[model samples]
Target: MTQRFMRATGRLRIIFGPAHSSSLDHEMTEENQRLLKQRQAEAQQWETIRRPDGSTYVVPKNPEDKSLR
Candidate 1:
């Protein structure tokens, strides 16, 4: 399966002279990467199964996880 990860380049602003815009952009990029990693980790713990009704459901591979819907 293809992995879905965000390619966030962060927000850029018009740097006229001296400003902390680059730092702010870097923060945003870091946040995006963190979230992307979190999602990938969650996906790894789940497995996709198709029901008899032709609907797909994501269930955790770890049977101990009682978060099944």
Candidate 2:
């Protein structure tokens, strides 16, 4: 077919597909893993305490209350 003849009959086409996401959670480095573990250890030290007045308080299980600062 001639180029001009083909161009006169050609129609546009559109294709769609599912959306995708790329995640970096699986790409942790050794230093990132170590820091995550350390932070988890520190978070484990938090405690929820109840008082005689029925008030609630959150404090570190350790003597130092870092959250207060």
Candidate 3:
């Protein structure tokens, strides 16, 4: 068969099958999911504080120096 004839099948790929996305979340482990949630929780507690000197810094909004709220 000619190259043009064989190349025709490549055009039908979209109708033939879906592409596999390796990035799908089905691969995430339970510990990875748990860590993601924990990081989100930690991110929420931060509050931006602008000082009169225009200096900027970050500290835990509720740093008990003991527990994670």
Candidate 4:
């Protein structure tokens, strides 16, 4: 029996079958890494506000002048 290995999302995965594990894993890993990095960058760019009541909310970059109810 032969065991195939694949890499996805910066992680290694093992597959057993006729599937091309190496190519598939490389592609998956690249795409997953790209998406993860993108998300991380976006998260860092956003500003979050935490309320004293243990609630958290995202602060809008632009706020309209409105009276608070």
TM-score of each: 0.45, 0.41, 0.41, 0.41
The residue-level lDDT of candidate 1 at 34 comes to 90
lDDT of 2 by residue, 1-69 (tens): 345554554442123432343454578889999999888877788888999999998887877656533
Q: lDDT winner among the candidates?
A: 3
lDDT computed for candidate 3: 0.71
The digit string of per-residue lDDT tens for model 1 on 1-69 reads: 111111222222233332233233345568888998888877788999999999999878997876422
Q: What is the lDDT of candidate 4?
A: 0.55
**Which segments of candidate 4 are over 4 A away from where they belong?**
1-28, 60-69
Taken over the whole model, the C-alpha lDDT of each candidate is 0.61, 0.67, 0.71, 0.55
lDDT of 4 by residue, 1-69 (tens): 234222332233333434443433445568888998878765655578899999999864435522221
lDDT, residue 45, model 2: 81
Model 1 earns a TM-score of: 0.45
List, in order, the clash count of every candidate structure.
Answer: 0, 0, 0, 1
Off by over 4 Å in 2: 1-22, 50-56, 64-69
lDDT of 3 by residue, 1-69 (tens): 444554666666567874343534467889999999999887878777889999987777777643566
